[model samples]
Target: MAGQNLTTSIIIPANNEAIWISACLEAVLASERLEQAEILVVANGCTDNTVDIAERYVKLAEAKKWSMRVFDLQIGDKLHALNVGDRHATGDVRIYLDADVQVSNRVLHQIERALDREEAGWASGKLRMAAASRVSRAYGRFWSRVPFMAKSVPGSGLFAVNKAGRERWGDFPNIISDDMYVRLLFKPRERYGVPGTYVWPIAEGWRNLIKVRRRQNKGVEQIAERYGHLLKNEDKGAFDRKQIASVALAYPIGFFVYATVSLIVRFTKDQSGEAWSRGR
Candidate 1:
């Protein structure tokens, strides 16, 4: 490590994530080669045992010579929680991970090492979508095959940036998609996908899946509407026509489910974006 690369901070913004925070921290505490790391769990508007569960990790963190703190806020805003976590973070590299995401042991270290550079670099681990339901699993199968998800660093559940990269933007704005906003700040070459993987669960049922998909589309539209310039850095690439045909041909059920979901999201009345949470 050189310069400020000496330290890494993992910031997790949690809202009523008691069901998932323990697993999230457990996976994080198992990171390797990250001797001096900080874990900031911002539990906002949590009515569950999220704060309590996070607090239990203090001893474990200290045993690893790492620091862990839980900040309980009265508001349930994800962006506000991220800003608060950033203000308290003390790392040259910052990893913003969702509370419901579970990283493999090597994920944090790999992403941290990838960002050790003089130039601004953004990075994230390989995404593995986990869905328990039949419909959601089918949709995830089709969605995961898309060019943006398979080829590009989607950074759906987690994204990390070095100190220089953080300067690309100020405090997170009230945006529908913070991940999209941040990823758009850098060009494709500036983004790196580590070899490690992280498990991100998909919204389970049709209603939940539709809600999440709608929010994602709304987030993209909101970004285009508000920060039109950042679109220049987007590298989603044209859809892979061959792959689409192959997937749809091989898995007609998944294709039908995915296509129907897209159609519903497209035709249904646009609702105001719901308050963001940990996919809850």
Candidate 2:
């Protein structure tokens, strides 16, 4: 498919993300090169001014000749918002973006070129964490060196798939790790890591960091228990013990912080409200 002919649908599921949604929309709108696109911000179960702020951008999006919609729902479930957004998205290339993450203007074009290949099933750009604190930056350095992190396409905060790739995995299951599920659906050969980077904020503060890590561990456990077969095709390289040692040796404090969080989460039990209150 020609890059210009491909339409992109960017779906952002937001819940009380009023502080971040406007900037998220702005970064996307700056892409400037898309021939046709629709930006859907599903502001569900928002108690703050998320919807009001998002609604303020509909006119701006229209002014730029881009189709944009902000759906306000009474409930605040991420899965519910994603399912709703998917139904209304009409573009051939569907991008699932987190309200807190920001992508470069060339990201959509990169995805277009990657998906132009018939064999490309799902794709995502490289993830770069914007951690301001020294502790968080050290942790990010260690986290980025893990074997799988360096090798395969890490499709955590932002990812996209063409129509054919979307058909491989239909509606997302009501699970916490929707990203992992999508990443595992296709074999390594079918996934593409396009050039460019998307900036994702690292959870700041010790409490918030642990909370996020615990939620992530819980999601991985859920995927392992329910979709073990799918993981065989994850396309990750072998775990390197030396690389782990090198990271830990160079950044002991960060490694200790990360390991402490992992250990705590290992002993924790899943709560009913985990999905809704994953972080602050």
Candidate 3:
């Protein structure tokens, strides 16, 4: 593990992400000092030109001596798409990236180097929330300052692990929160956060915010019920009343939006049996 040579496999599970895939790929292709890597865009159940758009990058990737493959599937399951990427990935390091996320130029390279040691460790870039609408901007500002997000490797849209670190799991399972499931695999001490940042987009407005919040709650509940043992690795600090008061006083708009979303999601009926979409 120590002094090991590494090539990273960046897996992007995209579902009708024609709008964002190009930006994501553009950011990735602009990496600063990555020696070698492959980009696997798993275009699952895409009805648009996602596959065609991704395939256009093949030559660009070739110019860098890297390979870019788009695995077009007829099914629209993220977990299944991820497992498919794993099967065809040839790199020693594995980086899971969401289609909507745009990484800083050095993110993949930094994470790969951080996980290059022999020890079993997982790594991710710093999370930066991007919001288009006013309400979402407020919410994102509040969220970006929360204790858990500021204190830990909250890999919402991006995470990477070396070969030794990946031995902890087999194929990606059918789960509500794939990110949560993978993150809880390692102890806090084993999670590494590099200096690079990735912009994770937020939902547009109120209705979408509630939808995403509810789905996130469901994901956490699913883990708590089925993979309860992984809870030991959970280090999310409690959302104390003092912090709440401080946020409410300093940023009423953001605090109100964030609180309203949580309240609505709290009263909603469980929709775990139904299909849940993350964003609009």
In candidate 1, which residue ranges exceed 4 Å CA deviation? Answer: 1-5, 240-242, 270-280
Task: Please give the ranking of all candidate structures by TM-score, highest first, separated by commas.
Answer: 3, 1, 2
Residue-level lDDT tens digits of model 3 in 1-280:
5576778899999999998999999999999888788999999999899999999898998898888898999999999999999999988889999999999998888998888888888999899999889999999888877888888889999998888888999999899899999999999999999999999998989978988888788899999999999999998988799987886788889999999999888877755565656665
User: Which tens-of-lDDT digit does each residue in 1-280 have in candidate 1?
Assistant: 3445369999999999989999999999998888889999999999999999999999999999999999999998999999999999999999999999999999899988899998999999999999888998998888888878888999988999998999898899998899999999999899999999999999987878778888899899999999999999988877767878998997787888899989999999756566554344
| TM-score of every candidate | 0.96, 0.92, 0.97
How high is the lDDT of residue 207 in model 2? 60
Worst 10 residues of 3 by lDDT: 271-280
Off by over 4 Å in 3: 270-275
Q: Is candidate 2 or candidate 3 better by lDDT?
A: 3
- Top candidate, metric TM-score: 3
Give the count of colliding residue pairs in each prediction.
Answer: 0, 0, 1
